[model samples]
Target chain A: MKVLVWAEHEQGALKDATLSAVTAAAGLGAVDVLVAGDSAGSVGAQAAQIAGVEKVLVAGDAAYAHGLPENVAPLVVALMAGYDAFVAPATTTGKNIAPRVAALLDVAQISEILSVEGPKTFTRPIYAGNAIATVESSDAKLVITVRGTAFAKAAREGGSAAVETVAGTGEAGLSSFVGAEIAQSERPELTSAKVIVSGGRALKDSETFAATILPLADKLKAAVGASRAAVDAGYVSNDHQVGQTGKIVAPEVYIAVGISGAIQHLAGMKDSKTIIAINKDEDAPIFQIADIGLVADLYSAVPDLVARV
Target chain B: MKILVPVKRVLDYNVKPRVKADGSGVDLANVKMSINPFDEIAVEEAVRLKEKGIASEVVVVSIGGAKSSETLRSALAMGADRAIHVLSESEVEPLAVAKILKGVAGEEAPDLVILGKQAIDDDSNQVGQMLAALIGRPQGTFASKVEVEGDAVLVTREVDGGLETVKLALPAVVTTDLRLNEPRYASLPNIMKAKSKPLSTKAPADYGVDTAARLTVLKVVEPAVRQAGVKVPDVEALVEKLKELGVA
Candidate 1:
């Protein structure tokens, strides 16, 4: 099986999720990474070092900048003849592009597969991770999105994959990039963070949510996350939401403050290696999955814990 | 300008789904069903566009069993001008649903097509992009803010990092994300009047699309349950446990 993996990069460096995707692709068979962007050559160099990658296909063009699905999908479809399966990280970019590629190829897409049972069969979570379904696709060419949290990252070095430049498809002229308001954070990205400190509605307001959560996150050098309730309540931006509908994170240490632990919230972080819950409500469902539970008011407990840490 | 919104009926967000004893699939025998929350937001956004005079009409569509008409009625009550109910008793995957919508769009020729990012049931966020690909139009997925500016729609998308805004030419597809808008409840009068609104029933064959399962389900099972662990007594003890675990 020859698998093609889309390389996701930003600011000239490959994202860590792409490494996880490469690892997932390696499971199927020989892996080739596709890096398409204005600065694809540099990103291609980074993708070449990933362990188990056989070759890195670089398509450098101005039209491919921003990783627009309109242009990217067609590019993937153009190269579909040499590969039997296409795998991408189930990030926002991958989700946006993979479905379009599948539709263009007239095939069904398997979204966010958790495991590769066979070449054609995979297991994925459904109903907000309430159930796992093992599905086998009959499509000739399989299009899949891998959940980065489920796969281990491929080693970043010790590979000598050859980088080859591929021709680019010009502008699709359907959509244009206007502008972006990317969040600036010094801490680790949530999906790649080793430790995450998440807040909930009990933070009362945005000011308190930040004031209380930031110090603790900073002390641990962890990424900040928020429950859907907190995001809906305007305690934080939508990007900070960690739930079934939001970003999934499985950090080494996950600390929940003031969260009641709804099923949706647990679906995103239940895979964490260690879970610690701090809520005054002793019966909050979050305590059930927490490895260490502390029944205390977050306002007092968080500050004390931060000082101690 | 006219807008098309595709809604989905799914298990109520509040109810926890239970896996069947035999593990065929989620038991939906007696579970409460409602319009998918994101689709409700999509309907609300389309209605708001109509009220703002940017759109002349808002038409909703739902593809499922006869019960899906109930979901269409809810969207109609939320101020949609009319609805199209495509009846199908069996499961329809995202790709087939997108093809059916493509056929509907060809007949309707609306200025914009809006849908939920994903149905909470399958959690497959694929239809909007697939429809765009099939119809040869631009797509704006995970849209938190949508603005119509004459010939183009400026959509602010909720990405992994933050918000990114893109400009798509007219007659594009957009999928709604959370924080787009707070959906309004249908008033009593609107609910009563929606019963009189125009709703046309069609079949997937009418669109010349085959609704068949392309993926065979080997089995369904519940995820591994996480067990509750030791509860510490005090802050110092919690800190001690953390140190013992080498996470602190």
Candidate 2:
């Protein structure tokens, strides 16, 4: 069985998550990494170097820069027959394109799969991570999206790959991108960050959050995140939200401050290796999963924790 | 403009899901079923659009067994103008569901179509894009906010890197993400009002749509259960335990 791993990139560089996905695609069978985009050439070269990858397919076009279904769906569908299984990082790009390809090919998709079972089955979290479900696809071809961070990223460099360009007129849609406004930050994205410091409604306001949470994040060299309650309360932007309805993130160390740890919030961060909670409420659900729990106000505990680190 | 919201029925998030002994699928013998959480958000958004005078009517649709109409009621109670039930005797794969929805689009000609990002049951997350493809319409998926402006709809999507704002022409499809909006509960008054709302039923034959499963579900199993970590006495004990395990 041949597997195709879809690599997503921005500007001129491949996203590290895609590399993690390639590492995961290793479990299926002989991998043929497929990189789609105008600047996909750079990403394709990286895929060929991955140890398990037999070859790499590069579909490059200037029009493919920003991932839109109009372009990616047809290209993936056209390439679907060449492989037995397809794997992609469960990023927005993967989530958007993989299913379209699966639909076109008339197959079911296993998304955000945490583990593969033998050859044709997978284990994925469902019901907002409250429970995990196992799916077995008896189809000839299997398509899956993996949680990129769960796998070890393979680093095999110094090689090249054959290029294959897919001709597609982008989808006729109601919307077009005028521009993008990225957060002006140096820290890694919250989803990809190994150590994350997240604040909840307990932060009180954005000013307190900046003064308390920011310094602590800086001290830990961790990414900053917020709870859904914080975003809803206007204490943080929606970008910082971490919850079932927001973003599902699993980090090495998840330090939640003033977060009561609602079931939805826990659904997002419960998979972290180490959980530390700082809250005045001893009964807060965050403490149930915390490796370190300080029953003190975040206003008092945060600055001191930063100093200690 | 007429709006179409595609809702999915799944195991309620609050309840624990049990796999069937035979592994056919989730054990739904007596489990509580509800509309997929994200679909509720989609339904809420469509109903809100109508209430805000953005859409002329909100149409709720579902592609599943006869029981799926219960989930459709969720949209009706939330303020959808009417409902369309596409009952399939067997499980319909995502691709086929999209094809069915595409046929509905041809008949209904809705200006906008909305659905949950992924169904908790299958977790395939493909129906919206597939439907968009079959209908030959642009897609703005995982959208947090959608507003109509002129002949286009401005969509704010949750991309992996950051928020992306895309403006698509009218007659596009958008899928709701978790952050889209908080789904409103149906008050007792609204629940009563929903009974009077129209729910039209149709078979796949009526729309000339196929709901066959190209990929068969051989079985479903419980995830490999893991041992929850034992709690240490305190922070100092935790550090000691970490050191005992390996490096402190």
Candidate 3:
């Protein structure tokens, strides 16, 4: 059986999540990988080292420098017709590209897959990450985007995969990227961050959020996340949202501030290695799973935390 | 330009969902059902395009049991010019949903199609991409920002490492991300106006499609619960404890 995995990248280097995606694709067939990025980027060489990948297809150009939906969907669709299954990471890029590729191919795709039983079957989460659901995909080309954090990174001792080029033509009609203001942090990216400090409604405003949460994140070199209530209240942008409707994170350390741990909120961060919750409500559900529980007002506890940290 | 938007009816996101006692599926007996949040964003994007003159007409569609009409109503209330309800009780896999939409596209020939990156209920972000492929159209998924210029669409997308931007041709599929746009609640005036907007219902058979569950729900198990742990009164004590636990 032939399989293909979409290698997500930025500026030319492969994102760590792509390795896990390749691992998921390997379960089905003899897997090959493909990356769309700039010509001078390291993603091609980086992809060449994944253990199970037999070949890596590079569609590198100025237009392809950024894996845009337009350039990627067509190339992936055109290349994947020869494979029985295709895989991509469950990151934002894969989520955007995988669906379009499946749509273009006229095949079923299972997203946020936790595991693969065979060529076309996958196990994934449903109901706000509360329940596990197994699904099957039919048609010659079955595609899926894997939850990357579930698997370990690719080891460097594997045999190298040959790199090939896909001469993709044309563009997708829609949207342009002007510029982005990334969350200014010297910390690891959220999914990859070992430490995560998240805020909730307790944060009265952005200033308070920055004052307390930023220090903790900076001290631990962690990522900053927010509860759904916090995002909806506009204390933070939706990108920082962590919940059933937002991002599901599994960092090594998760700190919840002024947050009541609703089941939905906990579902996203329950996988963290260590959970610490600070809230004025002693009976808050967050305390149930918190490895460290601090019962105090956020306004006072926050400054105290900053001084101590 | 004509744009199509697809939505799904799932347990209202605000409503906490729990597994059924029989170990069958999530209990929906009395839980409120509404359009999935991500799909609401999709519907909103389509509506915004129409409202802003980037799109001339918006077509909203959905496939499920009779109750899914409620989701279609949300689309109408949001601003879709028309609605198509494909009645099916069987769970529609992403591929089948794509096929049904493909069939509709053959008849409607919309310029672009948009849907949620993934439905919060199923957490499957597949239909949009599968449909885009089925129609042999380019696709942009998880777009934070989408702009229509002539026949090309430029999209700014969030990524794992950071953000990246790309441009696509028309007749593409664009799945919405969280930052895409805030979906406006349907007001009383628009809700009343939606009562007159055209919402037609048809069976999956009418579209020559057999709506069967391609993917079976083998089991539904609640995630393992986690318990609380050590708490230190001071940072010095906490730092010492962390060192003792080998996590500092």
Q: Pick the candidate with the highest TM-score.
A: 1
Q: In candidate 2, list every pair of residues with a backbone clash.
A: A38-A61, A70-A171, A173-B138, A174-B168, A174-B169, A175-B167, A175-B168, A175-B169, A176-B167
Identify the leading candidate in terms of DockQ: 1
Name the lDDT value of residue A86 in candidate 3: 80
In terms of lDDT, the best-performing candidate is 1
For each candidate, how many residue pairs have backbone atoms clashing (under 3 Å)?
A: 0, 9, 29
Tens digits of lDDT, candidate 3, A1-309 = 888888777655667788888777767778887877666236778888878778888776665655566566777778876887888888777777777777676566677888877666677888778888766654667778888767776664484988887776545544344566556556677777787889998898888777878877776667889997887677876678777656778887787988898877887788888788778888999988988877777777766666665
lDDT of 1 at A260: 99
lDDT of 1 by residue, B1-248 (tens): 99999999999999999999998899988889999999999999999999999999999999999999999999999999999999999999999999999999999999999999999999989999999999999999999999999899999999999899999999999999988999999999999999999999999999999998999888889999999998999899988987886766
Docking class of 2: acceptable
TM-score to native of every candidate shown: 0.99, 0.89, 0.88
Model 3 off-target regions past 4 Å? Answer: A118-120, A138-141, A157-159, A164-184, A232-239, A306-309, B48-56, B138-140, B143-156, B161-172, B187-193, B230-237, B245-247
**Docking outcome class, model 1:** high
Q: State each model's CA lDDT, in order.
A: 0.94, 0.78, 0.77
Ranking by DockQ: 1, 3, 2
Q: What's the true lDDT of residue B180 in model 3?
A: 86
DockQ computed for model 1 against the true two-chain complex using alpha carbons = 0.87
> Residue A95 deviation, candidate 2, in Å?
0.5
For candidate 1, the per-residue lDDT at A88 reads: 91
Tens digit of lDDT per residue, candidate 1, span A1-309?
999999999999999889888888888999999999999999999989998999999999998998889989999999888999999999999999999999999999999999999999999999999999999999999999999999999998989899999998889999999999998989999999998999999999999999999999998889999999999999998889998989999999999999999999999999999999999999999999999999999889999998898
Candidates sorted on lDDT, descending: 1, 2, 3
Model 3 lDDT tens row, B1-248? 99988889888878877888777789888889989888899999999998998899999999888989878987899889899999888778777788898888888899989888777788777777677767777667667888887888877775544455666778778888877899998999999899889988877777677666656676777767777776667556655544554445
